[model samples]
Target: MMKKLFSLSCLPLVLVLLSGFMGLQLAEARLHYNYHPKMLFVFGDSYVDTGNTRIDQPGSWKQPYGITFPGKPAGRFSNGRVLTDYIAKYLGLKSPLPYKFRKLIPQQLKYGMNFAYGGTGVFDTSSKNPNMTIQIDFLNQLIKENVYTTSDLYNSVAHVSVAGNDYNFYLSRNGSIEGFPSFIGSVVNQTAINLVRIQKLGVRKIVVGGLQPLGCLPGNTASSSFQKCNSTFNDLVLLHNNLLNQAVTKLNRQSKDNSTFVVVDLYDSFMSVLNHPSTNNIKEPFKPCCVGVGREYNCGSVENNVNKYTVCESPTSAFFWDLLHPSQAGWHAVYNKLQTTNAFQQIRY
Candidate 1:
């Protein structure tokens, strides 16, 4: 009887050990199981903007903007969802409500909030929208009002998309080509400061987007007949990305905790899809799905009930939806490539 009792106790211990071993195996198979974030905070420009721009904004509130997804214009810069939507989906959460729409839908506040504004950047751009610093102030106000508890921030991830609007603004204002490197350094430095600020604000994970290949955008490729990317522009983008990577690395090392920052390599992701279009099912990789009828117009331009922009028959076949933004299909393809990297994994837990 004594021997039997001892064996029974041993059985429970053995079972516990076996179960733990199985759990370890499962974790190895799926690394993200333990790192689920309760909410996502979005910042920066149009690449991640989802309905934050005003209804009067010509870029988003017009036809052919959200045509692919919502079947009408819904303030998304893309024809469908943008990068934020896909990233939210990957994390098993609904896309967070835009800051402008948060009060309108109080129930959706649990998912988090998006402070990104289209055509805005780290500094004041020509768009006259809130800069990134001011966007964070909006979050700070919410925190002060107890809209988000400390626990909410601790379980949240911040996604920052500073995708070259500052550069565009600089160049448009006749910024010297020779001084471009210094300008890029300043941009990256300020971005690093922003990332650190977000971390200090209680976000456990922060993902800063690397600049995409600026030369590959349809706007830049127009001179090349949308046939080839300008190597010079892409080289400048590489310098920006390199500086960003180094900054992130240093930030991680300085942290007393685990890795607090990650970079979404938009440059490599864009180049991969554009260079090997067939693999991504993109037929016209360089050409945009939407284009203006004239130089003064753009996608979604309409005057007197007459549309000035024309759209391709199949938006899914084209990599670019317009001059600067990606089509729904284009973003989906890029998201697939992003998953293959450790960008998502770093943010997990």
Candidate 2:
């Protein structure tokens, strides 16, 4: 009877092991099933820009910027791949080719096109190029020209990264804080219009990103010795995010699938990683890894060959890359937080 009981126990163990194996197989199948989006169309500014800027453009065509990437300035604004590259990798696709270089790299045409430009916004920008509306118009013109088919759009994902250039433009023009809300209204209205245009163009899943914490960017925090975030600027970001949330809900109702639109919360993700610094290896959580010697200089280049900037010995140990962008490591950490949220995960399908 003791031996019989032992055999029965062993039988249950064998059944349990078999069930675990089957569960693993089912999960793998689900991952593959959900990873079906074949293309990625990008819009907005530098956060998602994969080298859409001109070779003469100071932002992309510089050394030290891509020094960590392909050992050269490969058009990304960081030491390596930016947020959009990782998002494409997560979706099982290659980084979409820059819309500017689509003619040069025709093979990348298959993955989809990137319409984002560094330093540009929904409205006219300090950068001398088409704005967000013009970027979308380019894609629409491509569709009219038959560069991409409806099937491609239906099976694709789109990323829009409007990381507060509109507000920057407002401030640059000396627009008062009292007028900020109206400016935000204009930004969100145009953004919503852009979302609808992409959906109408037949794209199935669109992810519009929330602005990262502007107050935490080294540009805004430098005055505080990088010790504190400017809460005033952050407040405006919150307002933008609230409006974006409403816009996404409205667009989903209008699209073919209830899943037509999503928001990638860069604000919370940046704050989460900053609030809870990675337990291992990062040396500076808030300070930029790469920065110039003075306010007038930038991360990638020097003025009159004076070598005006400095880069940390290890880029991965820092969060901000320069005054405005995140390091490759910084983006990786933020991506981790983003993946934890359901908003981004649902876009995988």
Candidate 3:
């Protein structure tokens, strides 16, 4: 009976009911009214990245990554779009250009700039990519060069994604599980600081994504044969999101006039689709569609002129794209669910 209650296949009745309520309340509580932004500024990790990482490296730049959307690799970690593209679409704007492409397409900067790099976190991780703070520093430098005018900042929305790389880094360094909660607090606190710093830089609205269900990610779920989410890991995720929500609420009260802070509840959005994939036309929720040929190789690995990974016949039917990221269709499903909730209310346009 206890096992049945925790089974993700049926999606425990308690969680099924909570997802709906949390979506509505979290959005409404954090949003500000009657504001429309003409541009967007993105920061943080891969979930919102549209290819800021180095092309020479083996990542989004490799083949089969962007096959679904661009007919080839275009640097998005997914087989196509990601959260940033979907959010930009919702705002009726083209997806923002990556900071790396700013020199190549100077005129397109008005749409916005993406400073997010895959594998980065609020703190430094195994990836040498710039951390969230450094990403914002790049924006600040651009703003000083007058590349972005006061009007641009005033009319823009900032989207921040801090996924879970910090925790991954912590564990890799052998951070004890008993000490994890306190570490979670530090992550949330630093995240709140990042949000406030972005707000201070003159963005009218800022939306920081709450951490997704880490236990349900393919890297973790693989242990359960993709059949169950580790309840222990998920409990800590809830703690992270709850603390983030509180931090956002406090920022809304303390921020400048019209500088709104909202926490986008990606957790609920992802969980809703994972729990009910048929609703979104997805077949497998936890199992990734692309994987390495062996334990050491990853979705994009290649060796000695040979491909070291296998991609699905149709990526659109899969929820997860690789061990760590979602497929383009997976993001689309999450976005569709997001629209039903009140989360985007702050973006009036």
Candidate 4:
């Protein structure tokens, strides 16, 4: 009887070990995608921001923000790495250093820099920082100052993550819903200029993102009890994505390298993960695993100098970390979808 019991215990252990090994193998296989980039230079907003926000901003110097990362808040908006980190890892490169921090560590400039700032848009949003045009202008200045030589620009990869900060600003200022289409047009027009500007700045390859399902974000879904997505907002997101696709197509056509400008389809990826959570092993696809109790707080927010937000036991099971941002697991799922598509593939040189 004792011998039989020991055999059963050993069997379970063996199976568990085998399963873990198999999972590691699968992850390794996925990492083997035929893609590589010399350097990844990122711009735009919080989604791809690797700590470019000013110190005064709530996200840059907050707690619970980096609890899962380097054990302290390192300026990333999410619990851990964001979309850009995963994308850089996928391309076999380290997450590029933020432009703000780059000045402090000049050696990091060789790996490329992240010029993305949270809450800023192609045009100015609420953030009191450089807009997209000014962000590019900063890079232009860096080049003129010889911070990055022409060779670095020619061999580097550029990524822009202009989420809908402009939309949020419009909504906050009570911009009429009737003006939505025109606003979107202006956003895309400026985005196109930014893309062209980066290419002209000597960056060889570029990738821009289509907006995610803003309506399904934890913030938007909160009013609906997280049971239903706001389709109206999703419709607006689709319109924006459609315009972005057209712009990328046109930009590629006019570029000298004859290389395509890629669009990271965050919209489709978010929808896919939300609609098919089972496939991604996500238990809460819309509801944030971390949330504040009342309207006066948010993920990582503190009330009365205490942690107002409650964190789920397992962040990997949750799709959202906060109202506007995704959990690290959520970004992992989206990155998986992006890897399966040719968009990310085409950007690899």
RMSD of 3: 13.9
CA RMSD of each candidate after superposition:
4.3, 6.4, 13.9, 13.6
**Best candidate, TM-score:** 1
Tens-place lDDT digits, model 4, residues 1-349: 9999999989989999999999999888777444455688888988888887877677645877877776678888788879889878876788888998876888777778898888889988855777888889889998999988888888789999988999998888885567898889999999999999898898888889999999999888988889779898899999999999998888888877666478889999999999998799899988888787788776767767888778889877788888889878889988888888877777775
The CA lDDT at 220 in model 1 is: 87
Residue 16 of model 2 has an lDDT of 94
How close to the true structure is residue 89 of candidate 4, measured as C-alpha lDDT? 89
Off by over 4 Å in 2: 1-32
Using TM-score as the measure, name the better of candidate 2 and candidate 4.
Answer: 2
lDDT of each: 0.91, 0.86, 0.88, 0.84
> What are the per-residue Cα lDDT tens digits for candidate 2 across 208-322?
9998899999888888889889999999999999999988898788766887899989999999888877653456777888787766777766777667778898887788788
Q: How close is candidate 2 to the true structure, as a TM-score?
A: 0.88
Kindly provide the TM-score of model 4 when superposed on the true structure, using C-alpha atoms.
0.87
lDDT of 2 at 344: 88
> With candidate 4 superimposed using the best TM-score fit, by how many Å does residue 33's alpha carbon deviate from the native?
11
What count of clashes does model 4 give? 0
Candidate 2 global lDDT: 0.86
